[model samples]
Target: GSITHILIFASGASKVPLAGFQGTPTITFLEPGLGQSLPTANTCSVSLNLPMCSTFNDFSEGMALAIACAKTFGIA
Candidate 1:
């Protein structure tokens, strides 16, 4: 199993509810979306080491991107 992609999410200081996420692959892919790059950059700055990933500000868009990737990779 391998992780083909990575996605990070930011609610932009907004209230976001916590939820459980599941993936069929052995590797995990975080939420995917497009938003302010600076916030993501800041996040990465503190992240220490990350191989690959993208960031998103909106929930729906992020989920859509994640779903697309899952479909492309034959993941449920």
Candidate 2:
């Protein structure tokens, strides 16, 4: 029903966060802005990346995350 947690990726950025972050990250679920460009989830395989983002929003990140989760969980 919500993102239990997540790690966002930018182009040319590190894929993994630092070893341990015990605190839950405070994040904002921004709605799609006016014709904003969304990048493909290149941080990992689509299957491994998208589902982590789907439920909270309906933007490009959500699409990418859903694809990744479906791939990993086999629930397309």
Candidate 3:
């Protein structure tokens, strides 16, 4: 099966915003060097705030989002 959803855990210091492409709430990544582009076909991406050296409590948000995403895509 193909990947339907993606969850990205980025550092709090990163400048990337926590939203989808063009503020539409659709997750995507772009990297010209890697021959990547935005608006991945049939893919939903989400990025959560996660700082380095964080505790378990800090993982709650990401985990919650992951579950929600899974349910949204009927994965859970």
Highest TM-score model number: 3
CA deviation > 4 Å runs, candidate 2: 1-24, 36-76
TM-score against native, each model? 0.23, 0.21, 0.26
Model 3 accuracy (lDDT, Cα): 0.34
lDDT string for model 3 (34-63, tens) is 532112223233343222324455444544
| Better TM-score candidate (2, 3) | 3
Candidate 3, superposed: residue stretches over 4 Å from native: 1-53, 74-76
Model 3 vs. true fold: TM: 0.26
lDDT to native, each model: 0.29, 0.37, 0.34
Tens-digit lDDT string for candidate 1 (1-76): 1122233322111222254223221332333334221212122221212123343334335444543444433225
The list of candidate 1 runs beyond 4 A from truth reads 1-57, 74-76
